[model samples]
Target: MQCPRCHNLMVEQSFEDLRDDTGSLCFKGWRCITCGEVLDPLILSNRAAHREPMSGRARQKRSFIQIGS
Candidate 1:
């Protein structure tokens, strides 16, 4: 992938513990080495149904917490 801001190539990386009150999934985060932009693969897919494309670095650092039923 390419960084939307700098147009630099992005590097793929794994991120663990991505969840909330609604549960989560093991996802990947892409980061642009040039502009420090981070994109969450999961969020992009989920929001694609309703929202516009996601952009820029990770504004909120999100992590998953196992939910106990």
Candidate 2:
């Protein structure tokens, strides 16, 4: 994904918890490498459901969520 603010290429990266949260999701986030914009993979998964399933991406996304929970 490209950064909305700066039109920079985004990269996938992971981060460990910096602060304690009792019940927060602890997954890593995708961010713009140059502009520092955050992207939510979960939101992408939800949006993918609206499109026609031509590839395995949507199915894979659904399976990932089910496995996560």
Best by TM-score: 1
lDDT digits (tens) for residues 25-57 of candidate 2: 567668888968777766568767776666778
- The RMSD of every model to the true structure, in order and in angstroms, is 13.0, 12.0
Which tens-of-lDDT digit does each residue in 1-69 have in candidate 1?
Answer: 988889999999877774677576667799889988888866677767766434422322232222321
Candidate 2 Cα misplacement greater than 4 A, ranges: 18-25, 41-69
Q: Give the best candidate by lDDT.
A: 2
Write down the lDDT that model 1 would get.
0.72
After superposing candidate 1, which stretches have Cα over 4 Å from the reference? Answer: 18-25, 52-69
Clashing pairs in 1: 17-64, 18-64, 19-64
- Give the clash count for each candidate: 3, 0
- Candidate 1 residue-wise lDDT at 48: 78
lDDT of each: 0.72, 0.75
